[model samples]
Target: MCKKKPYLLSSIREGARLGIQECRNQFKHERWNCSILPSIYTSSSSLSLSVLSSALASAHSIFGYELTSGTKETAFISAVTAAGLVHSVTRSCSAGNMTECSCDTSLQNGGSPSEGWHWGGCSDELQYGMWFSRKFLDAPYKNSSDSDVLSAMHLHNNEAGRLAVAKLMTVDCRCHGVSGSCAVKTCWKSMSSFEKIGSYLKDKYENSIQISDKLKGKVRRKEKNHRKIPIKKEDLVYTNRSPNYCVEDRKLGISGTHGRECNRTSDGPDGCNLLCCGRGYNTHVVRHVERCECKFVWCCYVRCRRCESMTDVHTCK
Candidate 1:
């Protein structure tokens, strides 16, 4: 695919970046925080070096050892990235950048006349995007042995991510006929924003289920009593429990919460008491300056006065 459609390389990179950034944003208040580690690779060809220097600089940054640890975080990463790829590829298709695909025309000239609306504009072509994402991301696990629990978990989460994109698709309509009267409407299907997809995946992560590491004919809950419960395609799954993430562990690449900023008030995950893991926190007064009290001038410019304020900031001890 890369050899045939080189233009998609940019979209693929964008998708990866989108996924990693969303992962970090969703976990910002958590102990893990989705921190990345630089990857090392060797290539003898100059072209590979050029590609590495420019487009693929941070390609492997998100593949921390934890990704293979079979934790919930890993599930979230897999799902988000898979969704991101579908999003970017669909966008590229809509923008007319790709030769193999374009906006979906299946619904054209199809709608109920009684409802006074028709499917006319370019509905996003999600099918092609979904197909491509699956082929590209799932190829590695296709031949994996049945005992590869981590591979199975990743494959399931990848589908969950793609499913999220499909589930959140919405219909947009434009009114026509004499200054936008309620006479006619053209509706088209559109994808939800990537932020929404990330939020959905985060919710799934919070409720992620732990599956038995030992693969029997199919995946089951780690707990024997709940093994009868059926796992849904949309649910995120993991095989291993995560580290406490309160103290630094170099071996696992967990930075822990030391010196991390925390909210002095509130009882959420960001609260000092919880984020600090009972080690306590330190308070500091920090000064902030920014533009304020702006006014438009007669010309094409505006003027503003600088404002300064001192606020208390807290960090985990």
Candidate 2:
């Protein structure tokens, strides 16, 4: 319910768009897709945003960023937001849009390189990104003693997201010799696409840690837990239990799966058997048109004929 305005509204909006789009793209195939829209009667606003107000008001609330009872959603949002911040700022720095930062030149200044290391391209602007993101995104949790448990979990998950990005940093290299001969090379630390980051976070979500109770002002797992190992800094953490998500619950922020399309052949969560929540599904035939029998013209364009196809569509009742 408390929203703080970030610096650089225009740039933040652009960054938010990138983050939201990436989240949606990553969760498209999943059941709990990252949607920004808030129900007309829901009390909780998913995201701490202020990320995209116009779209939010227009009914596209997007990935909920606020810490909720649902640990999975909270973990994902925190990670995605951090990842988004890193992705956007790094891109902006490389693109020369921001005046405050520029291409990473740390390696060019006598930094020791390991074997097979040719660090001479624009290094990933992760340092700047992490700093700026910490300042911007951590504003809400700073100077607050109340909600220590929730705040700690969120902060941990946020850092976990950043760590995910760092873990995925790769050495991007290109040969600089004529005909690609074995000569000089250019390489830089590059980040994986946001989709990959999301997938990684999804795995983290599946294996998220549960905070049984606060121990000496720190989160501790319950003994006798299946995951007996100590939690890693990169692990996602949650305090509250999640809902079943079988029916609509506005306060819980679950829209339910009714009327949602399901794949009949799929055996996963998206399968009709599971998605419908044992309520059964309704099927109907849908017709669509497509371009077919296209042939390339001499050296110009090509023409194609229209073709019609029909397929069965299934939706949860």
Candidate 3:
């Protein structure tokens, strides 16, 4: 069995789960929905609902191992993993659960002493979290030279993920005063919500860079006219083309749109027309009972009445 890292296994598991949840939350309305992870495999016997051509099966198998290298998938994974790492580390540190690290001391205060403000709160140690993330995540790919397109792509995407966190760091401040007088202010740098980071990374994934081949240990753009343009360290890079997820195919590891919930009024990819791959969908009525007419109680609790509602639910055929 392989030995674990310096970190606790529970922390690692929590971090991974948080990251995956962030990805799902960001992609909840998108076509891919970040379900490509954990490996969506369909066997020939299990795919009786949709017959798979032999050629398609072979193509599917090729893509099974290639998920880690896929451009969009790689971008999502990297961003989510980075976000989760920071979230887990910072929270753990703040809760006094982490023994190795605590609040940040390196973060600088913007307002001068003569001005009005200074950094004073227990700032989240993003640098330590980022350093730990880089060391832990990049360990497997460290020995790989830049010439290896796959490793190069993963590293670049991973860095992009970490950068997303760094780019979205926000400043939170509190006012200190006597009575109504404003005297001084204390501020600390904090991370933006994971949702925001995930959304930002999703945009990056949509606009990710496509590289054809490596030249002299460097990734070059696929377009000949853009070959001279060096890839940015902040941008995500992918070497392989993504497969169409419209249909279910075990070989390609695609979970087709059949039976997937869709919006009837939507014209986007999540709409029934696009999501069902033009195969059509079935509509069914769903009844929901939710708490309604909520009122605050004397102490603090809320009292509510049950209300019934009904709506049409559409599923791809």
Which has the greatest TM-score?
Answer: 1
lDDT of 2 by residue, 144-187 (tens): 66757767776777788888888998887777667877466667
Tens digit of lDDT per residue, candidate 1, span 1-317? 66766777887777776777788899899888887764333354222333322222223344566778899988988898899889989989988888889999989989976999999888998988898888878876776665498888988999999999999999999888897696989999999999999999999999999998888776778999987889999999999888889998878888889999999896999999999999999999999999999999999899999999999999998
The lowest-lDDT stretch of 10 consecutive residues in candidate 2 is 51-60
In candidate 3, clashing pairs total 3
In each prediction, how many residue pairs overlap at the backbone (N, C-alpha, C within less than 3 A)? 0, 10, 3
Question: TM-scores of the models, in the given order?
Answer: 0.89, 0.83, 0.81
**Looking at model 3, which ten-residue stretch has the lowest summed lDDT?**
48-57
Off by over 4 Å in 1: 38-61, 145-147, 295-304
Report the error of model 3 at residue 255, Å. Answer: 0.9
Q: Please write out the lDDT profile of model 3 over residues 14-129, one tens digit for every residue.
A: 56656666766876665566663233236532322121121111212223433454557755676567567767767677667777778887756555667678988877777767
